[model samples]
Target chain A: MRRITILGLTVLVTAAVLVAAPLLGLETIDPRQVAGGAGAGPEARIFWSLRVPRVMLGFLAGAALSVGGLTFQALFRNALATPYTLGVSSGAALGATLAIRLGAAFSLLGIPAVSLAAFAGALLAVALVYGLARARQGCSANIMLLAGVAVNFSFASLILLVHYTSDAAASFNILRWLMGRLDTVGPDEALRLLPLVAVGGFVALALHRELNLMSVDEELAVSRGVDVDRYRVILFVTTSVMVGGVVAACGPIGFVGMMVPHVCRLLIGPDHRWLGPMSLLAGGAFLVACDVLARLLAAPAELPVGVLTSLLGGPFFLWLLVGRRGAACSA
Target chain B: MDANRTLTPVLDLRHLRLELDGRSILDDVSLAVREGEHLAIVGPNGAGKTCLLKCVNRILRGWRGMISVNGVSIAAFSQRELGRLVAYVPQVGGRLTPFTARETVLMARYPHLTPFAAPGLRDQRYAEDALALTGIGALADRSLDTLSGGERQKVYLAAALAQDARLLLLDEPATFLDPRHRDDFRRVLRTVNRRKGVTVVEVTHDLNCAVLDADRIFALKDGRAAFCGPPEQFMVREVMHRVFDRAFLTVNHPTTGQPVILPEVGGP
Candidate 1:
């Protein structure tokens, strides 16, 4: 009951923050003034075109990645598992890099070329992992993780090769994107990606019970009338869309997917019905708060939100590992 | 007793063959378990006992031949349908998270639940009743991770009971428990079979325990049924020697009049 209450309060707090962010008198210029045709001032354009979209994108990306992380972790039944652990992010990065190298225009369909490439790359990576793992009888969690690591390493090398060959300007842009900055996102881009994220998130939510059973024991899950292979395919594909979509919009934001779910699991019990959705909401709030801190701490020039999340998540993860080990050792 | 009245078999396996890695594991194994009957499968290690159990639950899908439950081919049934009919409990071990005992049992109802729908009050009531029946209602709120080996085994049994399956397949349910707990586990199984009429097929290495409760005993040798009959048949020295490949002295229990086999000194 306490945990439920905490989750409820957290949801309310996050909703309030998301709603009141724009309305707060943080800056002198009123967004209403700029909208009322008051000379089309720079501040109003920045508010509408820049900060609002960036905030929205941060929330969307954070929620998507975190939920993807929860799904992957449960599906694999590995504590160290994440969506990118399978090389999806690296694959997406490589695809985006190749697209940029081919001179594809970002404004072609109101969707960035890089994001499109990333999505395609992520799907391909998932296919590759599934294909390799399925070849040996059935796709067990251990085999999938091993396959993912192999694919990730291979793709990382390709990404590095691309990075070396690219020109200075392209390299700089790629480097910044890889660090995961939400500064360049516009409101239109967030609107474009929201539907895909929401749909994928909902599909994931629906499979929570099956995923929980899968986490316990795959063979047991099969006996329980769950089509284990089919559910695995659905879960992997859905996570691909969520993670691939986010990686495309913003470069691989490390640890959001990894840390958020683990933290949520510790706070709430291992019930996926609550764990999966709460991870998304908490992850979104966490990123927004981190983004706000990144902006305020380095006003005029912002720190990459990914950097802050990693800085926070890395230490917390190590602490959890030590604590878990201590508990196991003592027990 | 009406000896002419044939009891309907709840589980039947005919001409069953299992091949793994180009090696035959189970070959032409045939068995029939009557409704509400308690059957025990005994075999030496690596005798394909586990493989046979897996085949019954469709965990090993590549097996050949006929396996039917309630007169329907198991292959024709969907996974959900199979789950509703059969509940499988495997040997328990490995990393387990801390789920409350009630929550753990509630997972058994997953097959009955639709995607995105929560369990109704009826489901909860059933779960509660199952917990009470298993005699673990007091431990319902405790974390599974904190339970002792014996307690954990009971919890799993409760979960299987909550599934409300017609046939229960257990692989070595008594392997990790002490003698007392093992007896308790068998008592629960006997009660469930008697009251709920749930057919039980369990794989066990304990020959003594198998004799104590099994209505029918099937002794497997190299993946084939070497002996299938009453416990008294297993005590015959010649039968034991042929299947177990050892010399044994058969003696009658002074009080119970049951044949008991004791390993004889000197030769096979």
Candidate 2:
């Protein structure tokens, strides 16, 4: 009953935020206007085409990254593990940099060329990490972690090379893209990320018990009937795919993947059954809140929501950890 | 468990060999354990005692040989099937997850459950009963990380007991337990073996434990089966010396008349 109440409250807050966020941007949009079907004006287009999609993109990206982070953390049994631990973000950044440098102007299958390249790069990084870290037994956590770090370094170097050789305009574009944005061209980007989040989130939540068992001990999990090797690969692939889509849509928005799950874990306790759903909902709402602040903090101008997430998340997470000493987090 | 089933071994290993990094851990080791029998695997350090249990539990794969449980080849069984047949407790407790004690014990019901389903009333009852049997009921709500080493180990034992498998493979399970808990554990093992008709295979360095608790003693030396016989035959000095590379001073227990093997110290 208590768990349900907690989740119910989260759902309420997330719905409220979802309803209210799209209307509170630089442009004023009435609640009834948002509720009623598309009207004919600049306001209707701004509300329907711009604000709503941007907020949806923020929510999708945040939910995907946070779930990815928690899944990785549970898989590796390390609290510090994040979505980009295996170089997915760095790989996406490199690909996006290349796309910007080459001035790729084509879209395929209703998705932009840059997003496709980003997804491809993210998959490549995961493949490389898996191949390098895999042993006869499987991918051991320590080896995989080290492999991820190495891959990150390599991708970052490549991204630096792309950034350095580009002309001034392209360099600035790369710099701004690196900061991350939730400015959607339409509902398309949000729609693109939706299925990835749904599949990844559903799989992770459905396998919550296995995640618990695996988090405790790989050997124990196997002895208790979990196919550790097979599930390990499944988990990695799912997280990578969701993270790839998110990174493709909005560049690599940092901190949501790293911080949101920790906060959710501390709030809901580490039972992934509850933690999984809570992380997804809270991640979406928290990003919406941050994006709202991003629009409001600098009136008439806006900072990238990514910058605010990383900046706000560091101090907030530090403050959370500072006094409590992870009393709630450790559970 | 039946009279006729006793004629065939419940657990059998043939030509079981394991190699790690080009060096053999277990070389052509073979043994059979009867149903409802308590078999103690006794050996010195690096004698592959733990490795043998792991092989039986199918935790350490890539071994070259046949392992059959209940007359069926282990290879034919899925991991879940194997889990329902055999339970394992490591030399020490596995890593501590964020679950409380009761939650940890409930996880042992995994093999019997479908994916995505929560543990039902029977599973919860078994978990509670296991915790009570292990004398850690008061700690049921405590997170595993907060428990002491001995307490944590008891939680793991409770988990294995709750697993309700036919065979139990324990690797020095009492290494972290207090003497009182050890006595309680021994009694629990006796009841589980005699009353429940469950097979037990324990790896222990303590020879006294073997003679006292086990129906048979299987001694290993350099990963080879040095001795496999009844406890009475295994109590002989020649068998002990061959497996352990040492001299033993054997004395009969004053109360039970069972021979106890102790190390012979020259200076003393």
Candidate 3:
């Protein structure tokens, strides 16, 4: 009952923020004027095109990343594990850099050329890790983790090499993209990402029980009727696609994945049934809150929401590590 | 040929061999267990007792042997089917998540639950019953990490009992218990065996506990079956000494007439 109450409160707060966030920009949006279409001018265009899309993008990206992060953490049984730990972010960055350097002009369907490249790159990286881990003694979590770390480092160095040789325009783009931002074209783009979040979120929540067992012990899970290998493969593919979409959409928003799940777990405990959906909801609200502060704090010049999240998350993460160490020592 | 057909053994393993990273863990081991029988596998450290149990639970794959449960090859059974037949209580616990004792025990219903379905009322009753059976009903709402060693041990046992499997595999279950808790555990095991007719296979280093509880004792030495018979045959000083590489003085318990081996030492 308490968990349900907490979830209800979180959802209420999230909905309130979702509605009020777009109105609190540099030019406050008057809902009455916009609703009746009487004063639907440049202010309306900015409200509909810029603020609404940006906030929705933030919410969807946050939700996808949080689900991805929670799944990865449970899959690896490591609290610090995140959605990008498997090199997807590095891969997306590399792809975006390559697109920038190549001066790609074609956009597939409605996705920007650079975002499409990024999505492709993230999938490629996951496929490589999966293949490498699967080829030798099955796709175990340890093998996947090690393979991902290796791939991440390799891609990181390659990205540096690209930055080293690229022109000033391309270099700036690469750096800006790597820093993470929620730059959306319009409401249509944000709406396009909703399906990915919805499907991925559903699949993740549905498998919460399996995640609960797997997090405890893989061998024990297997002994208790869980097909560990099959579940691991499904989780890998689901989280990869989810994280890939988020990275492509928002240029690898940092810390939303790691920080949100940790906070949710602390709030409701480690039962993934609650942890999964709560993290998704809380994560979306958190990013919206962060984006609001980002807009309000710097005023005309906007700080990247990702930067603020990292600044906040980094210290909390350190505090958590120190707190856990202290507890372990005392125990 | 006998007029009556022989009863099929509940468990049968033939010429089982397991090699891990170029090292032999179990070598040509074989055994058969009848229905409702309680068996104990005892040995020194590194004697492959746990390895044998792992093979039965199908945790360690790539073993060259035929393992049949009730005349059906274990290889043919899906992991879930195998789970319905066997419940394994590992020696060392995993990292404690924030699950209460009730929640932890309720996980034993995973095999019976449909995918994406929650545990039903029947499952909750089973979990509660298992907790009561293990005498940890009062601790059901407590977080598992907050429980003491003995309490945690009972929680694990309750979880396994809630599995409702026919075969129970325990690895050094009493390692963390005091004498009183150990007695309680033994009583619980006996009740489960007698009332539920569950076959039990325990790996332990305590021969006295084995002799007192098990109908048959299987002793392993260097990954081979050194002795497999009733406790009377296994009570021989030479058999005990050879398996453990130590001298033993045997005595019969006055009340139960069970054999007890005391290690021979020059002093103290």
Candidate 4:
């Protein structure tokens, strides 16, 4: 009954946010205008072309990141894990920064060259981290974590150097992209990330039992017949690609990856069976709600959704930790 | 005994050797257990008793040897395939994972069910049978965190049983249990061994329970196979002393009329 209630609440929140968030903005659109065909008026154009696409993109980014985050936490058996735990975000940031610094202008498949470059950077970081961890036989989750730290710091340094030498305007642009926003994202960006989220969500759902066993212990997982190493690699590579796509599309929208799964675990519990879908739904709704707040709180001058996420993530976790309502550990 | 000798061993290890960091963990160990046999492995700490079990289950690799379950090499089967043949219950010191006793047990049926497919009637029946066999059916819905150590160990046992494997490997399964729960656990294991016709191999610290329960005992000392035979041979003072490097006293239990081995408590 409790599981059903929590899952129902998640579905409700997702529905409410999907329906309500797009209708709200700097200029409110009539629901009937949106219900009318495209280009019925200016409101229709804004609704069809801008608000809906942005909310969809936000949903894609949140769902992908949260599922990825849940997978990493289970793989590493660490509650602090997030989609960015493996250096993908830093790599994407570096790629975008370098592109902005160099003024790369070759777009392919209708994708901005910057997005392509960010994706390339993300893959490079994952490859490097995976290679370093595989330097020895039987790569453990701890080894991969250390490898991620090494690559993340190195990529971060490179990004700093890129930012430090760039012109003022380009540096500001890079900084803004890093802070992440959904304001200008449209149908094209949403379409690009859809495959990634689909693939990531599929892998996570398929390995739900493995996720549950592994979170208990590696030995436990092995004894239960999980192809521990192979599955770990599969999960790692898939989530990296999905997260890379998300960061490329949304500029590493922060907190949804870390915070959503944590909060869902609190409301529901650690059974990955429910946790996987619930995390995806709650994550999407949470980010959209925050995106709405980002627009509304400052009206006419929008706060980047990334700024609000990080600003809120730390304090909310603190509250979850210190409040007497009591938070349970993943174990 | 002649008919048993003709049957293929349910578990067989041929000259297994494992070395880590320039030290031998298991040295040239070889043993075989027939189907339905209950074998106990006993040794002091670091004797590689648990390590031997780890090698069988593939949790610890880098060992040079051949291991076979039910006449097939361990290499021949995928991990999932092998899990259908051998279930391992590791020592009960694992993190209290937030699964209910039932969910944790049902995970044993994982290797059997297709991914994304709900448990069929047979799968549910197997889980229920395991729960009933281990007498944990009442605790099936209880979260692992809410379970006591003895209760949790029973949950692990139930999980292994639910795998419906032909053989079960346990590592110090009752270390956390008190005397009463330990007896209950032993009783459940005996039922699984005798009634279900499943082979059981376990590493144990309780010599008395081992002698009372196991059909045979395999003792390891300093990474070497020290002894293998019927418990009647193991209950002798000199054999026990040779393996443990300490003296022992043997006495017949007044109630059970069985030989019990006790360590020589007084100095030399």
- TM-score per candidate, in order? 0.93, 0.96, 0.93, 0.95
DockQ of each: 0.58, 0.64, 0.55, 0.72
* lDDT value, residue A136 of candidate 2: 39
Which regions of candidate 3 deviate over 4 angstroms? A36-39, A135-140, A324-331, B1-6, B253-257, B266-268
Q: Worst lDDT window (10 residues) for model 2 chain A?
A: A322-331
Q: Per-model C-alpha lDDT, please?
A: 0.81, 0.86, 0.85, 0.87
Order of quality (DockQ): 4, 2, 1, 3
- State each candidate's chain A TM-score: 0.90, 0.95, 0.94, 0.96
Evaluated on CA atoms against the true complex, candidate 1 attains a DockQ of 0.58
Candidate 4 colliding pairs: none
lDDT of 3 at B82: 86
User: A128-223, model 1: which lDDT tens digit per residue?
Assistant: 987898898677788988999999999888877888888887787677767877766457768877987898788788888887788777887887
Number of the top DockQ candidate? 4
Displacement of residue B81 (Cα, Å) in model 4 is 1.4
- Kindly give the stretch of ten consecutive residues in candidate 4 chain A with the minimal lDDT sum: A322-331
lDDT ranking from best candidate downward: 4, 2, 3, 1
Q: What lDDT is reached at residue A307 by model 3?
A: 89
